[model samples]
Target: MTNNKNQNLLLRSEHVWKVFGDGNEKKTILKDMSMSVHEGEFVAILGPSGSGKSTFLRVLSGLIPPTEGHVYMHEKELQGINNEVSIVFQNFALYPWLTVRKNVALGLLHSTISEEEKEKRITDAIHAIGLKGFDDAFPREISGGMKQRVGFARALVVQPTILMMDEPFSALDVLTAENLRHELLTLWLEKKIPTKTIIMVTHNIDEAVSMADKVCILSSNPGEIRVELEGLPVETRMQKGSDHTELVDSIYQIMTNPKKNPQTILHDGNHIPITLEESPYQVLPQIGISKLKAYIKKLMLQGGKESIRELNTNISLDDLLPLIEMMDILGLGGVEENRLFLTELGDAYAHGNTEEEKQILKKQLIANVSLIQFIMQQLEDGKHTIHTSDVLKHLHAYFPHQDAIIQLKTALTMGIYAGLFSYNRQTGRISLIEN
Candidate 1:
């Protein structure tokens, strides 16, 4: 759905700065941020909570104006009446007492247009969102998923040129969220609205990868654009496999590693090569599980005395499992009392291929915390310890990622065992330790 003429840049933001409060109390959310989206492109803003993703969207949607910088649509400066923009919020924001039809029609009320036109728009929106049969149902009468559909319908009724969704699917159940995401992807692909542009804000890395043509990752604190990743979101997930595992590992590295640049040595006796500002995924140390397995095999065959831990020290359970699993999968390494040990295959590589193996042994042991922190990040400020389910709900407010929540539960279990917290899985009750 690209605008053929001036399709190069549908939306552009220059040095955007959103500040809150005043005088000494001022807080700058965005700092000198600049980016552009082409017409019909699904661009996603990926960041932790309080990273100013919502602020960016609000300014783009004309709900709030930026304190600094300017935004342009079709190369024209955007001011008040940017009619081509529409938004769907995470809270559903549907009128509880109003039926789906009326809720969707509320957006059209400001227009002087006749009721017939409004009805036609509302009906079309409902049908497009696959909620045709739920037109007469109130928000409470429908399921959470359907209520979100009403929200989408409400936004879609306006038929804006640009669609802004701030974690719109984050309120639904796991299955429902996945279903709605799939539906939206299908709609975007099939409909191909030429004037359409989508800018979605989400904390879920997978969602950004799954639906966006461009994924913009934001840094913390004074939220600023950190990096932009481009790739096609695979329609089907292949868990525990090389392709899938590699992508996940790469993303994890980019998000976690602080000192990303690393020194490297090649087989040609090249010593201390500098890698400047490369995506953590592209660095040799952060190679995928499958590639790591292959490299280990090659190194073992080379047969040289070298410490494996020195080469690869900063590996976490989450990213390291797949690598070890690959060793088991390929029959290259053996497990000894819950530890991974070099087998005949590994011993062979470690002995002979000193330099070549050294190249492969470069490891980035960037310390990363449990995935629970990622979920906790989605929550607003609160002091009380929350149940696992409640924590999951907070996660939904940003990224609707149930899998990450599961990881958080696993982390919580570990934390409990470490005396950091107390938990009972069966009851799902959790309490923080004073220490």
Candidate 2:
């Protein structure tokens, strides 16, 4: 890690607030958030989905104005799109009809430079991004990794002072993403690119810890900066059992602290309360049922209970927390005294056959998941079918609009897998199965 304590302040946000919609439908995405980035620094904004991580990045790059507060670039107020800032989007944003060289050259279209200078810069940018001979290749002709390289080259050709990336490597395969991450780090360390600062938005905890000099964690549903971790070196993060691991653990603690929010319990028709811990929109399980069953078996093998910290030593908090929460939601497990323990249902599922496991899952989903119960009740009432829009409207009361859509889709998937309901994608409607 480079000592950037004496470096100049490149960008800062003060009491920033971003609100979507209007009147009664309005939702606050970011709230009173303030943070700063320095020159020669690599910063990461880390949070779960719907945490406004990308929205904050857009605000920082001046792609969108905040509903309140202010953003400063080089100590001056940023009013609109900052000419010195550029962004690389997750989808690569490449023109399929244009060749790599043409796409990169587009970055210089508004420049006052001569054609010869533009050609030189374009060639240099392409080469810098490791796309040398493929300059004439179209986006469709190259691999996903190469297309993302074109994205980097396009952003680099403009010679922006700050580069903002919205999960830039998320679209690639694991190996490809890893290669790109290393290549980016090499460029930043070698000073091959003219950009002075890099700000990235990501949900991957390991990615943030491995890449960024500083990490800012955001909480969801009116996102706010929950914590800022600094001075984390790549070397330190890679070293297991180091202080870096402790820092990562601390982050998980902050994110999962039950004290931060109220715990809402869903009730079945029998009026039995089922704990639905974690975020409001996290009604969907992040891991597949098979993986969850395997985790339960592992827990049982290890005496059916383990401290959260001990469990984290093997599995990442990202994977572990969601699985634990899902288990609790299904009445398969619970957390007590900071230890996770499997219940009778969880142990049975862990040892059961595939069909039996599915049965258990079906019963749990119908009983604990409100959306599933609502769909079933609607079907029983002779509705026959429920439009996805209606489900989204109901979910909107609990989650943000986008999150509501995601939760509904996830519920549909789980419901279909459990033989509870069938979703017609073409018609955007869900109907109960003849169980």
Candidate 3:
């Protein structure tokens, strides 16, 4: 890790706000977000999906302009595309027809450099990323990890002062991701690249802890930088059961705490009051119904509650946190302190037969889930059917495009399973099932 003390500011954001849409339908993605990165620092931006991580990155990289405020690179206001910054995408954005050498050389196409110099830089980048012999290989001929290396090579060929990674290794298998992470660290430590700072956007908690010199946690529903932890030693991250684990757990708590203060916003240069009702909606767990049932049953068998750490011993935190949050959303359970406890509804569902479980879920869907209730209300408002586009528009106000689709699909699935509504896949319409 780089020494933070005496480092100069490399980049900064001043009260930046990114708002999509306009007028009444406008949705703010980033609000009054101010943060800075120092030279030689590896900063990880951690947030849940749909938290505008990628949007923030694009704003910082000058690919998109913020609706309000400013982003500065090296103390100068950034306008339009930033040539000093390069991004590695989640998907290896490599062309199928381009070989490794040609792909990497593409970065130099717009440069004033000579062809010979471009070839040298391309060769050096390809070799530096461990793709020397595979320079002639097409993207389809390479493994996922190797393809990502080509991404790194392409980005490096630009000789960027800042490297922006948007979940660069997320598409790889676990082992491959780990290996690439270590390789990246080795490159950073060895000063093999010209990158003065690295800013990564990731949803994986462990990956952030392991690689970041500083971790900035973003809160969703108008993503804001809620927490920033710095000076985390890389050595501590390598050890299991270390203080780093506790730090990771603390981040999880910060993200999951229901009563945590809502993020404040600036409206027309005045601090706008945020009502509790306007607070970010709780994210529904992405797990299936069976997984939710099994986990609730396990909690019940374990005296109706268990410490998250204990539960994690059997199931990974990646899998456990969502289920716990789902239980909380469904009024089935919640986390207090470090423990997870099942509510009366959760306990009943655990012991109930399949039919009874469905009944309980249906009741919860109608009572707890706002989307389902909205659909039900729409049906009651003289309309038996609602277009999926209408629901999607409603959801897009809260979530990103992809996440809005996921949330809508998930809600529709649950509603269908619970017999609350029937969706016509062919017509893209949803209708309430008559009682």
What is the lDDT of every predicted structure here? 0.62, 0.80, 0.82
Cα deviation in Å at residue 27, candidate 3?
2.5
Give the TM-score comparing model 1 with the true structure, all chains together: 0.59
Error (Å) of candidate 3 at residue 55 is 1.0
Candidate 1 lDDT, 84-108, residue by residue in tens: 8878899999888888899998878
Per-residue lDDT for 182-263 in model 3, tens only? 9888788668887888999998777898888888888766688876776357656545556777767666666665345423
> In model 1, which range of ten residues has the least summed lDDT?
262-271
Model 3 spans with C-alpha error above 4 angstroms? 1-5, 239-241, 261-295, 301-323, 329-331, 336-339, 353-435
Top TM-score prediction, candidate number: 3
lDDT of 3: 0.82
- lDDT tens digits, residues 1-435, model 2? 343333799899999999999854678899888898999888989887778998999898888999999999999999899999889999999999999999998899899999999999999999888999998899999999999999999999999999899999989998999889988877876788878999999987767876788878776666788767673665564445566665565556545552332112111132212222354434565667667877898999998998777887797766786787788888998876557888999888887887888799899998898777777888778777888888788788887676677677767777888888888889998887885
As a whole number from 0 to 100, the lDDT of residue 435 in candidate 1 is 36
lDDT of 1 at 374: 36
Rank candidates by TM-score, best first.
3, 2, 1
